[model samples]
Each structure stands twice: as structure tokens, then as C-alpha cells.
Target: MRFKIGIIFIFLCQIAQAQQSEMTVNQNHYDSEFKANSELISEFENNGKSNAEFRLIAKSNDNGKISVYIQNNTSDTISLSHQDYSIYILQEAMNKNGLWKPIEYWESSDCGNSFGEIKIEPNEIIQTKSTKYSGNFKTKIRFKLSENNKVYYSNSIVGNINPNKLILPNDFSFTWPLAIMENIGKKTPLELQKKVVFLEPNGMEEFNEFFEKSMNKKN
Candidate 1:
């Protein structure tokens, strides 16, 4: 009877451990998305020029509008010197053969509108409405500095775009380098290191194919 009880306890412990692991994964994904958004907001506030730090807070409304909040954490006021900002929504796609393809990029400006910029005071938050895009996808918000369009600071919030639909898979099994090796002819060592950390070794072909398709389109 003691041996049977021990086995039961072990099985329960295993189940608890598995549950904890799944929870940790979910929390990590949430934290990653939050951090990405925060980084983008900081870039916009500082315009890649100021040393002050900022953060982003993204909240989804029931009416399908995403409200992005920009806050200044420092004691001094931070100014976002941009006239207009833009938000891009990327949808995940699957090929006919049941393989996960590259992300489909859609811009809010393409829909004939854009988000305006606002000044964020110290210890204050400014909110802006986000444009809607189709499918279960992630949000990448960018704030462009008025001085030079090419030197824009960007941040991506990783979450499901379609709140009504099922959650999208968050597996990092795809390798982007193999798919775009021809495009990245002379990559820097730092770029190579980032690729190694982000992409899976065996999924290069799949990553490249999806990237090619996505880039070729106007959306």
C-alpha cells in the first residue's frame, strides 16, 4: 500500500510540474511582448537621441480598438518630436501543405489613415487608437521621428490580433537566415549571432519561402 501511495504522489507531482511549465511559457511570452512595446515607445520618446527612458502600455478594447499608452517614467518631461506615427499588423499564414508560412504584413496607412503623435508629460500617459487588421496576428507599432524618416524607432507587441479567435501558436521553430541567405549576402557578426539565437536550424527552408512570398506582395 505504501509503494502504491508513493507512485500516486509521484504522478501528481509530475502533473503539477507540467502545469507549472506551461504557465511559465505563457507568462514569458506576455513579458516578451510587453518589453518589445516598451522598447519601441522609448525609442519614439527619445527619438534615438535622448537618454531618457519611456514605456508602452497596450490594451485591447471590446470594440476592436487597441489603445496604446505612452508614458514617461523619468522625472523630466519627454517630447515625441514626430508629427505622425504608424502601426503595422502582421498576420501568420499557413501554406496549402499544412506548413506554417511567413507572416503577412499589413500597414495601417495602407487603409487610408494614420495615427497622430502626442506629447507625453512626465509621470503622464498618452493614449492613441490602433487600426484594425485581419486575422490572428501580432502588432508592430513604430514611431517615426520627423527629422529623418529612415531613422525611425520601432517596437513590436506580440499577441493575437483576433481576440475572438483561438490563440496562435507561439513556437520559435522557424529559421529566417536559411530562407534569406541570398538577401543577406554580407551579414555582420552581430547579425549572424542574432540569427543563431532566433532561428531553428532545420526550419530555414520554410522561413525563406514564407519571407519571399510576404515581401513580394504590396500589403
Candidate 2:
């Protein structure tokens, strides 16, 4: 009986030590990478004949301010229609069980008329604040584009903040302009466009098969 009691005490000591070590490791990981409960999301695009590109990046500062970047990637004149553009941000929080929950949303448009119908010449990028809307972060970020009040393109970006890394949950996808043109009778030759890249959850092999069948059916 004495031997068994001694062995049980030793085993309990070992378990306690292991638990302490695990807690230390978790704390160290959090200290190195985790931000104080904040996240950002943004999107942008270029509408030019050539390979023009635009990007919108968002960052959450320590003081609860969100900064936005509108970057242009071409050396030619680029005209931006502010009426056709908008920016949105969503904030989220983690619960005690580590599940992410939506907190709020923010949006901006026109910049109080101080910026309107803006035009950025080739190679010029603009950075501005979204003064039109402000709220807490929500669960998703959506960017939309339109012409004459009709939506021409839209994209959705989803991610969650983990320690010091922003893990992108999936690949970003853009609607093909050819599909839009076809809807408007813009002379889009369906036969010339042979491949369609579907960014859905389905695998690439399935997407390719579907594309082939759709084209065959149309023909």
C-alpha cells in the first residue's frame, strides 16, 4: 500500500509539470504574433484595355483606425469614376471557445465630396480615408463595381486573423468580363473563349469537365 501511494504522487507531479509547460508554450506563441483583436480587408481592380492592375489593401492600426491603399500598376492615363467605386470593411471577434463572430461593418463613398469623380493619371496611385461610414468589424468583406448604377463586377475576400498571420481561407475570384459582355450583346464570340476558370469549392478537374460540356452544349 505504501509503494502504491508513492507512485501515485509521483505521477501527479509529472502531469502538473507537463501542463505548466504547455501553457508556457501557448503564451509564447500568442505574445509573438497575436494582435489586440483587429483585422482588415480590402479590394480594387483596373478597367483598362491593356494589362492595368489596381489593388486595395487595408490595415488595422493600434489606435483603432483603418488605413486604405489604392495602388495603380500601369504607366498610362487611368480614369477612375468615384461614383462607380466603394470600399467596405468588416470587424470580427473571437469568443472564449475561439470561434469568430461578427462585430460590425464600415463603408466609404465620395469622401464627403472632397474626392469625387476622381481621375488618376498613369502610374499614379491614391490613398484616401473612408469618411462616409464607420462601424465595428463584421465577418466578411465585399467590394463592388458598377457602371451607370448597374453592377459590372464584384469580388469577395474572406479570412480570419490568427496570431500574427492573416490566413486567407480561399483563392480570390473575379467575374469574367466576357460573361458580362455576352449578357449585353457586346459581340463576345463564345467559340473564341474556350476555357473558363471556376473558383468554386469544386476541384479543377470538375471545373474543366463542366466547361467542356457547357461549350459542347452551346455549340
lDDT of 1 at 176: 28
Stretches of model 2 off by over 4 angstroms after superposition: 1-52, 83-115, 131-219
For model 1, the local distance difference test gives: 0.38
For every candidate in turn, the CA RMSD to the true structure comes to 16.8, 19.3
Indicate the residue-level lDDT of 73 in model 1. Answer: 59
Q: Write the per-residue lDDT of candidate 2 for residues 1-219, one digit (tens) a residue.
A: 999999999999987554322211101000112222222212233333434255445444344333344444567665544422332222333433556432222112223553345455554445433211222322333322222222222132343322211222121122233443343222323322211221112333444465566667678
TM-score of each: 0.30, 0.28
lDDT of each: 0.38, 0.34
Expressed as tens digits, the lDDT of each residue in 1-219 for candidate 1 is 999999999999987554322211110011112333465555455644444355554555576555555556567765543212432212222333544322322111212233343445665655555533343344343321121111222244444333322222343222223434444423323433323222223233444455566566624
